[model samples]
Target: MKKNLSISARLTLVMILLLAVIYPLLIAAVGKLTPGKGKGETISVNGKVVGYERIGQKFTADIYFQGRPSAVDYNAAGSAGSNKGPSNPGYLQLVQNRIDSFLAHNPGVTKEQIPSDLVTASGSGLDPHISPDAARIQIKRVASSRGISMQKVTELVQAHIVQPVFGPAYVHVLKLNVALDEIKH
Candidate 1:
């Protein structure tokens, strides 16, 4: 009976050790095989790397398009919404502040033309894309800055508007930036 009990204990210990070693190796192998968003490559301009799909950076220049609003100050590890419900007083205040800033920078734009994505932070603070309307709204400013015709800039924006890979939605910011870089050259 003692020998039988020792055998059972040894079997359990071996199983535990096997799991401890194999489980992590399996997980690591799967992680390596998985294709993570923004892990493939970054879009470069004139051999200068600009940004990654996972990060949201501020684009203040008039010659470039802007991305969606960020809540965690564009920190990837801290990605999250402001958690303010639509009715929250803080939400309204923040929206108003964002609107004010947008107007300040885009002095030529009217209130009705501002895109909703520009004034509201995305659920994930690291959104690297903006709505097509947002890109369109910035065309005048970008054209003026680059001294290009509005028609040319508009055509470029339309060309960069990426239709949803699977459906009807689209992403416009990355393509817009790439086009803007081309215009610079």
Candidate 2:
């Protein structure tokens, strides 16, 4: 028993050193090779920093295209999902409320036309990208609110679609909103 205890203690010490120290160092080293070096990729406009590329922003105004409903209310400091399953009554009720709110803001848009991404919060609660379809669905409301033609709004949404190498296309909501502000007409 004495020998077994000694072995266990040594193994635990080795694991702690390996996982708690060395692993983090290795990850940081790898992160240095990526864009923003794992700190965050900032989106700037006219030399003013607006937001991070990976963190979503809340745009509730009718003139702006809203991003996903954030479980953390787009608070980067407290990123998380609702963690409620689909069958959970509270979760369903929350989604229903979101759908209703979206319809109220976007007149002439049917519930079926609204994409799920527009109504559901992402797992991270900080996803910056929304599906192209999600952005498209909002063009009508945004154009009307901004007094721009739907064609111009659609063109802007199409220009912002990012076809990543590994996943489906998505548009950065912050980028889109910034461009929307730049439109003189």
Candidate 3:
């Protein structure tokens, strides 16, 4: 029993060193090789950092296209999903509320036309990208609110679409909004 206890203690110490210390350092080193160099990628406008690249934020104004509803209220430090399954009553009600709110904001937008992404919070509440279709649906409202033509807003959304090598195309909400601001109305 003494020998077993000694072995367990040694194993625990080794795992703690590997997981707590070495793993974090290795991840940080790898992050340094990425775009933000261990920090998140920032989207800047006029030399001012407006927001991070892959972090979702609230955009409630009618002139701007809204992203997915966040379960964690877009709190980066508390990123999480609703954790309630689709069949759960409270979850259903929440989604229904989102649907109602979206329809209210987006006039002429039918419930069937609303994309699932727009009404449901993503698994990671920080999902910055939405499907191109989701952005397209909001074009009418944004164009009208901004006093721009729908064609122009459509073009802007098209320009922001990021086609990955594996998955379907997506638009980064923060980048799109920044670009929208840059457009001369």
Question: What's each prediction's TM-score?
Answer: 0.75, 0.82, 0.85
| lDDT tens digits, residue span 1-185, model 1 | 99999999999899887898888777777777765432544666768877664566767677788877777877666779877798989799989998888787777888799878889988888777777788888888888878989999889888877786686444557656777677667
Candidate 3 structure quality by residue, lDDT tens digits, 1-185: 99999999999999999999999999999999998998988888889887887788888899888889888888788889878886999889988998998888888989998889888888988898899989999999999988989998899999999999998889999889888988873
**Which candidate has the top score in TM-score?**
3
- TM-score of model 3 relative to the true fold? 0.85
> lDDT by residue for model 2 over 28-87, one digit each (tens)?
999889898978788888898889877889988999988898889998988899888879
Better of 2 and 3 by TM-score: 3
By TM-score, the candidates rank as: 3, 2, 1
> What's the TM for model 1?
0.75
Candidate 2 local lDDT, residue 120: 87
Report the Cα lDDT for candidate 2: 0.90
**Could you tell me which residue pairs clash in candidate 2?**
none
In candidate 2 the C-alpha lDDT for residue 175 amounts to: 90
Report lDDT (CA) for all predictions: 0.77, 0.90, 0.89
Model 3, residue pairs in steric clash: none
